[model samples]
Target: MNPRTMHSIFLKKKRTMVAIAMLSVGSISAQTFSDFSYKGNDKIYTNNPLKENEFYSPILQGCYPDPSITRKGDDYYLVNSSFSMFPGVPIFTSKDLVNWKQVGHVLDRPSQLKVEKGGVSQGIYAPDIKYNKYNDTFYMITTQIAGGIGNMVVKTKDPAKGWSEVQKLNFDGIDPAIFFDDNGKAYIVHNDAPPKGTEQYNGHRVIKIWDYDLEKDQVVAGSDKIIVNGGVDLSQKPIWIEGPHIYKKAGKYFLMCAEGGTGGNHSEVIFMSDSAKGPFVPATNNPILTQRYFPKDRRDKVDWAGHADLVETPDGKYYGVFLAIRPNEKGRVNHGRETFILPVDWSGKYPVFENGLVPMKPKLKLPEGVKNKTGKDGFFPNGNFTYIDKLTDKNLDFRWIAMRGPRENFITSAKNGVKVNPMETNIKALAPVSALFHRLQHEDFETSVSLDYKPKSEKELAGITCYQSERFNYVFGITKKDKDFYIVLERTEKGESKLIASEKITLSKAIKLQVIGERDEHQFNYSLDGKNFKNLGGPVSGDILSTDVAGGFTGSLIGLYSTSSNDIKP
Candidate 1:
């Protein structure tokens, strides 16, 4: 045979081998995706029954952060920070740690603490709730806005009766956790205020446990001891360690806490010691829970993942509850930090974090005999409305809140609509006195308000709006623009206003304006008469409702607002 013919035969054989290898790789990849059944919405399937040892299942949805759970016999009660939302500290009850129901709110009374000036995202910080069986009292501690280091506590025998007046604690810190030792010695563990030098209000990364005296109302036992200051590594400087809680089992003390910033760097760390007050040692494994090492193929990427609490079942199983943020289409975290649950085990001297980096898909078994309850369809029967008396039973839902602290003189009930009296203050400085707001909980929920607006001056703008943040908002109102009574749609950003829509329309002595939001977007529609409607250009892409983006302690709120500096008589 010729030499050139032999070379051609060898080249063809090499091509055939390469094609076979590529086919084998593609077949294996297809099997991997099929085995997981991975899809959107972070849903996973497993053949095993739900037990107390599975990892990676989101327990709650929406911004349910800083979870504090207390197990009372077979029932468990959990509470999270509500921030500026009226009726703060939402309380949820569960039996098997899977299904939960919002039973009531802890901070609803006026004496709880004023949050109007605290701004949106700054009202309440981390809250710790615990029940003292011997005293039959429920105790909760939370930091008040503008108040210094220490937090305030509220106690009540019955959660239905609500909490009592806020009692300020002596310690200067946030994330206050209460622990009652087996010997009946009550102690408080918390993070200390940041020392000067690092980020102001962001340096002290230590967990201190002190004896708490209920009668004296102060922490007295131990001085602030630095437990784990990022393990003496300056490269990881300014690790903001907060949210400390202690758990003891089998004569070993487990101190769990949050570390790093509360954004993408958030994580949970565990320190163990034989004594409560000790030279605690960080687990050699370290960082029991974190997103930095997340698996490559997980459907959801958790940004902020920390602030956890541990709960025990009646049959002696351990579970850890924490919060994390799941990203959305725009690469933004609109859902905020939601609550999650994972089963844990103690192997050797430290708790082994199973499926720590991979999002756990646990098969949760709902507790027997517990029924899921739906949100109230209408307003409370006894709730007093200012403008419209006798609201539909489903009118007043958890979605509603008053801007600033609500005042009695600002609103009242009437036969036609809810009567809102313009207050003698500017909306920018003073909290919107008569503003009634609710969360845009659903991405495509529409909100419309029909009210009689009597603007006393050009400065007084009264109507409805969909606010994204302090820097961005869209409003529809009847205003005196260029000495003409015109219906207009205004867009305000960083306190600067631009008229998006303006037309000469007859302004009634009283007119109604309506605003509708859809698909996490918004549209401005106005009405001079109750019948005719005009569509304003909208559907802008931005955060329709969020705490992180909107710059408030509460979620995206849609409500009625009236702003005026002049005192108007009703």
Candidate 2:
């Protein structure tokens, strides 16, 4: 489909038909589904109330992307790259591939992550998590950019208990993966820096393989070799040939990597070689899976479907989970890169989606025992009303992320509540400031936080924020202009903060601040008595703070923030 058709399908001017249903199962209710559907990508979402043999689309929603999955016995474990978000590399588990729940994060401790001054989308890159049957250990390999410590690996036998400290690996390029041969030999494959610089072409990259030294925990000397250089078809000059995964299937080594960058032109290519490290040959039909080319009758525009990993169920069926984005009318995506699953049809020369995959499918069947589930404790729909206390132990939940680590000192807890000392820097600064937030998991959700902070100056503000980046965010907090203190709602888009709305009120020692997000707009509210809330004139366009609008790898983070001037003392 063309860009125009994609827009028409989602544009407000076009009266797109929306079908809704209610499905309730037990005490849990289906709270979320795809908002709108196109002609080909029609999705009729229901809060499926019954326990059935079915699964929902976008199985793991929000900005979860670059998925790496492995199956052990009847259980499946998956992990995704958490860029700049603290407690990085969220790991998930599922009996059925369709319904997944977060088990824990690989980098849950403060010492594992160090993205203080890192760029918004600069911390962790694509990570490959695998289970070594020989040693019975789970391993996760990843890269940290923007003053990061480079490539590293962490292992754990029980992911729920947490992972071990980092075993730093030396690699020049990023997007690393580990493959263990059936012979019990371990190998590492990664997207390597170009022997020839990038000016050569757009997707100029190399996939290198190395023999890993398990005892020493490093790559063996002189064992490094380039397997797939410059992607499948070098004549086309592929770019961003990254996210490589090697698998031994049918007695041959299968190598898969995402090419054509990570944007609209994104795609997946496959190569085959006899040896784990060898001169692999590309499949005749190079791009085994891609949404770029479409048949005339197809109507859905699920662009950027790349960065995939393969998994086999107990039944021996294969499936590929990749990343894709659903764009709005303006062709700007706010959802970030979401995970999409497809049946990997292996009947052909190489495995691929038989007829391509849609962004959202109405119904899918899973094994009978596999039931659709959400949340760690229960299914909490994305856009539901849930209040989180400032001092609850849930503050350390996997969903609660920080700008960086070593947070115990700055973010402290008291018997009454959590105390956030203002960092000597604003949110706009590149350096990590004192900030705590939760991912904007829903397109429409209500969030409110209680703040007892009394800002003595403009630099000592503490309240809630709808953050997109350092430059783009909507801050709803209390700041002092002079002797008079006021509750303020400021819109900071494109790095400039302008007072959009304000209300002068007397503080009762504590106040309730709220932000209600409705698709493209957000409303700010405040309550002095905790009973009634006054809308502080919001309806601010939230599209400007989206991934497409702001151009980043992370989605909006809405949570508590406190900032002071760089020179201010705590």
Candidate 3:
């Protein structure tokens, strides 16, 4: 059979596998998930809904940034950066490229991820997952910013199963991606600072390529070379040229990278060369994908778009997955950088992201015959949807995540929900806390939970936290204030904690605590009975939970938090 014809058949088979996997995913969840991690029976209803023949542009949302895609024949896998959050490097699978199901984290085991002592933003960064057909193995290469483990790679025949131990690479850079040539030679592409004293300006980075030894899983000695410097044009003084990936197509080598930092000026630029390690030349029409040129107030605006990876389908079509932010009405990024996809017009000499230059529409038309299964079956949810997790499933949902340690470390299934054993470290500490977090997915939303707890002492507290990081967050929970139990709301900004409000409460029964996020503000409420809610704090500014104010690469996380080192005095 012809290669193209075989790929078509393989796609059909893979599509069928996806359907079966979606329908039967919950049945096999126990084999993958740890049950009842912090009891987040959440219901999120966003305002963006899909229209006919359309799906959401952000195939994955809420801090899922720096998306890299890889293809093995008809099957596709996508991965993202996971900084400090334990079980780093979230990996997902898709057949149609629209619907995605998280197979699991790439660094799922404690031995694979050692971020326990690193800051909240110092774990995995910009992981690139690529399938090497030469060995029939998948390689996930990334930079671990913690524990002195710099650039690393892990391999596995199947992604759904657990991955191998980390193979630390001998390099000092960020965002390392491995590319395998057709002749079985592999190369490593990454962004690094220019050779010492060669720095012409700040943020002056270069893209370098090295011959990768397949047998040793190391970059070949003395084979590294600089392919691109100072981005597309030297006169422009381009900043932060990073997140590089190489592709070999039609006997030509393409090196795509994100330029101008990760904020508003961010963009994807392309360069081509005849050889893998090359004197590559920038494309005449560069910045193949960007949202910075559009007006800031454009309707349904998407901004800070860059850090992309591309993949070609079996039918000769191309798509680019990148990170972009959807700022709230107050012009703050509470949603952080999300994963968005756009079709590529690669028919020309250069691949341009179609509809990528303009203000992005929330929806994309589905491929010819692929049905949209988002929010249904086992695929990841997007657009306008209401997701309800009842805290009763035998297996934990893949959506639940923790920081610095595995969710299993502090959570246990008991009494129809998760029992969080309060850790010595508090939410304000750099170390791991006893909390399970779900991303703050929507700008305007309400997240509520029932907590049956009576503080035995002032040090023990259990409640909900709207956290941007350890330095900036809000802690609302039950704590004993001098022999009296009270529900207190505390705000921590830049490592300083201030009491926002406190209510003396009788600990007679289970109480429902809720946090309502309304784009610019958040409201804390409590209900003695499940339905009757009384506001604890009228409204608090959401500035602390925004990336713009907090100054981090991550978005706000809504955590079911419990801690034994409580320091908030109310």
Candidate 4:
């Protein structure tokens, strides 16, 4: 909802379309409308009320955090951490940096990403994608934590055609980032333990650099050097010194990192050095960006702002892509960490965030000729337009992700839709489960999928699910008992499953399950006639699936799924 303009209302009821002016914070007058449609209050908004020179924050939404951006010519490419989701490292391209469209995933093939026994939030961590102009190659270096493959690099001349094989790196750390210097030298910077055998504080960490050899596609031996120890301002004891990126600007090397962990105190710090390998010095005003300085307020409380990457526009102006959280409730961030873009201020020695660490600015200025774009919340009609996963489609949608890496034969052709072959492990297990899901783009959206499945025994269950992790999820599935099919709504939290509601019906046909998710609450619905849906249970509080409530680094996913007691082949 842009704060400047008021668009027309498309109402199902003729007399109820009345325009009302609402005064919001930031001294902005917004014209809001309550759009009524069929099925009572369908709670849908038509489109964003766009205003000139006014853009929305959070350029990328819904769990797309730890962003790494690169500019090639007039085109901008962005990628984010996919955590445990298979087909990881979602890639997006933009012409004006305002309107972005997901182009592909870095880990698109089964061989490229294998998350068989990976934990819920353990596969990939903070991937850094860089384009080498001299060699005409794009490189992606990341840490496969749960996969136990450590830091690895993958490259491609044409990103759309997939990347080269994994080049295993011997770096002993997470959040590995590759920096290519102007002198045709490449360096790898990462967060690692503080000098092995030295006792340190809980969050004490160090940033190390290594000469990367692109010719051999490996790291140069005996070139490791500690760049920054104990973060910027070592006396302050800044914890969780991670997410490092090195950039050369105005003949000075700038090292950026996230400090104070990734939660409430998360912040972006800057260090400058004469050489990439030399000792880095902290800026006078260290922690170039942070949200912790803001006074706690009831109206607006945004937290967890850090993990940033910088990209210079064609005009020589710089912009930054960072991660932040929008908590629906106090201490409850349900939407997960999101990526935001803000202008970079370089009047001083070190670059700073133009807007500081403010979560969502009402309006932001864009580059010349670029249109302002905004993100909306509600039951948007075409919000899922890019997702093309159909019942009869042989290939899954690019937006659809599997639990960890998906097996080639997991989903096969069925009568009218795809049949999901359930793995032996359930959702409670630490290993990857048999589930395919799409990102929960909006917290206040309804997702429902109809499946033609009648379980043969209690071992087989299949329906829709709102999953946060292996140990935290809500499922509306149908479990069979001999001749009867039991439609059950279950909740799993911390490896414990509790049935919320259940209904028994004769084994007749497939069941249609639905889950309505709102900012405050959630509800489960089921339909047998395909025209009418009945409430399956009472409203479940939405906080259960939140990152604040269910501690993790990833967001929730809502999609169709199937599972069995034993390995069920499609």
Which digits, one per residue and each the tens of the lDDT, describe model 1 over residues 1-570? 432343345435544653454355331111000000001122222233334443224555555678888877777888888765555777877666765666666776545746666555566778888877767677887776633424778877766556676777777767888877676677788886544464433354656677778776567744556555543233557477888888888888888888876766677888888878766777767678877666544554555677888887887767777887655544444445667777666646766555665564443433344332222332111111122223233224343456555423344333444444455453334353545554433333344566555443465656665554444555666545445565656666665666676666665445545555443455677666667877766555446345455554334545466655521111
Model 1 CA lDDT for position 369: 46
| Sort order, TM-score high to low | 3, 4, 2, 1
The lDDT values for all models are: 0.58, 0.71, 0.83, 0.72
For all predictions, the C-alpha RMSD in Å is 21.5, 12.4, 8.4, 12.7
How close to the true structure is residue 373 of candidate 3, measured as C-alpha lDDT?
92
lDDT of 2 by residue, 1-570 (tens): 432333233322212211111111122111110011011111223233233665554566567889999877777888888887766888888777765667767876545777877878888999898988888888899998745579998887776666777778876799999998889899999998778544477558899999998777788878889998788877877888999999888888899999998887888999988889877999988687777765423433457889999987777678988887655444556667877777788866578764454333434666556655643354422212243544545135555567764334345544456655665677778876667776665555577766776666655677777788888887777776666677777777788777787777787557877777665677898888877999987487887668877878877777577766521221
- How do the residues 1-570 of candidate 4 rate in per-residue lDDT, one tens digit apiece? 211111111111111311121111212211110110111111222243336765555776578989999988888888999877877898887767777777678876555676767776888899998888888888999998765688999987766556666778987989999999998999999999998776367899999999998898888899999998888867877788999999998889989999999988999999889999978998888777888877666344557889999998888888889998767644566668988778998867889998675544534676778764322221112222222234565454466677775533355444466656665566666665666676765556666666666676677777777888887888877776656778888888886777888888654455566677666688998777766888887899777688877888988777566666522222
Best by lDDT: 3
Q: Quick one: ranking by lDDT, best first?
A: 3, 4, 2, 1
Comparing 1 with 2 on TM-score, the higher-scoring candidate is: 2
* Global lDDT of model 4: 0.72
Please give the range of 10 consecutive residues that has the lowest summed lDDT in model 1.
29-38
Error of 4 at 172 (Å): 0.2
Structural RMSD, model 1: 21.5
Candidate 4, which segments miss by more than 4 Å at Cα?
A: 1-49, 298-300, 372-389, 413-415, 506-510, 566-570
Off by over 4 Å in 3: 1-49
